[model samples]
Target: MGQICPSTASPLCVGHRHLRHSLLSHGRSKAPTEFPDLSFLPPEMAISILSHLSATELCLAGCVNEYWQELADSELLWKGLCYSDWGNIDSFLPDGMVPIQSYKRLYLLMDDGSSLFNGDSVSGLEFLLNNGVVGPSDRHIGCFLHESRRLHADKVLRLLQDRRGVLDELVGLLDFHDVFLPDALRKFFTEVPAPKVRGDFLEHLLTKFSRRYFECNRDMGLPQDTTYVLCYSLIMLSVDLGSPHVKNKMTKREFIRNLRGAVQGTPGDYLVNLYDNIYLHGHVAKKSHYKVYNNADF
Candidate 1:
């Protein structure tokens, strides 16, 4: 036999591996065999469905074939992915170019550990130093950060208000090393337990968040926040489940179960989205995906 082709050889091998994968994952083992032709679907409709997919899905979709790759990597699709992942990137961009240009590169670079994974967190400290957007967050921050090794607790103790309370709260989260999660870190960890939010709590949350400058917007409205929350399924979407980039292939639905439990251990009608943390209100609710007309509608 000729030299056996190793799957790990080169770029060409990578492409072949993807080709082999596409056949199995999507439909058949043989390319020319009779099978369902998904490519015949209108491109716009296809891309829209693809848009509802996570960042990793769109990348994997690109590997399926040339036409699919072109559609998957289109500027329009990647733009939505960029905004969904990082809100706004103006601060992260170089001068003299608009957002999508940075987004094009961002799609490739987001996986780089050095960009976000290695930051020293000046922004969180700045918020605390500002006495926080609503001032009451001072207590919250202090309680959350006092003994935090990540906070350089000695330095934060001098700069922050409510030093006593922060220290008291900080004791619960502290450890000897920088590796331990602070109270702030604990909130984002889906596996960690959190207090259950009560019934009709979304309204209370919206109202509470609206008062804070950090939570609401320049217009001081909750509509944008509310809509985004419903669309992205809140903190549930921020996680990486079954990430093509990772060794494990857990689904996004499984991922959101962790977030939902962390956010509120018990559930309510408004919070349930059986759709794998994608669009909670998109197709099933028969609701328009456009703007929120009434402020109270959410």
Candidate 2:
């Protein structure tokens, strides 16, 4: 003030402005007075944050803490995703979501329950029915059937036979199922009536049914030809789905019994021989005169 120094006064004013800004920033860094303590945040809020993450991220976070691993593996989370993602669709199968561990836990109910996404009791059944090689999509129904061939062969063979009239539309699916057929490609091209009909339909149905027959009859010691006839006849009978077809309710046990008897095995309600597919074409029925159980059964 004695010197009346303009430079000094200006420097002081600038320093004051800088100090004000630094103080403001420090004040902002502090929590608002109304803010709750972060350390005391509710567990629900924490879970919600974690739930927003992707599957890979969730998996990674699981490794970060034991609590996270428990939450991540909770079936509720996966089932919620399944229901939210595809449960509303007409063709959604909860079992289709089995790749997710949580959904797998609910798979049995999803498949059999009435509150299904499709409003149908059979979970994936609608999806399998509507989509096929004919559907514009990639048609995964065939893949599903192929996976069930061992346990559900009778069911699948019957389903395809019912749809044989539309076999042309099921090309891709038939190809997939045919993979289970030993030497399937060769048999379809060289020895089967498949060339005349839709090759895919015959290929799929025959391969699957034939495999089942072989597994159930090999040890019965039936001549090779008798076994082939048995398998083929069973395929034809189940698929007919006609008024007179064996459409009456028959459990797997009952069907197996009748099938074994038809093949000249012990007259019981289950397969007696239990063979494999290695000898499919090696033998042939000498008479081919086995009674057609029911032409309407197809």
Judging by TM-score against the true structure, name the best candidate.
1
| Alpha carbon deviation, residue 292, candidate 2 (Å) | 26
For each candidate, what TM-score against the reference?
Answer: 0.30, 0.25
Q: Write the per-residue lDDT of candidate 2 for residues 120-169, one digit (tens) a residue.
A: 21334544334221122323333333222121223333444555432323
Residue pairs that clash (backbone atoms under 3 angstroms), model 1: 142-166, 143-166
RMSD of 1: 20.1
Return the TM-score for candidate 1, rounded to 2 decimals.
Answer: 0.30
Q: Which residue ranges in model 1 land beyond 4 Å of their true spot?
A: 1-36, 91-99, 113-298
Per-residue alpha-carbon lDDT of model 1 for 1-298, expressed as tens digits?
8655674566545444554555677555445454333365556656776888777788887898898888887788877775565434343333344425444455555433212222432444443334221124334443333312222322332332224344333333333122211111222121111212323433433223223322223342224344334333432332223224545543545544644654453243234433333332222111121111101111
Candidate 1: Cα lDDT at 197: 31
lDDT of 1: 0.39
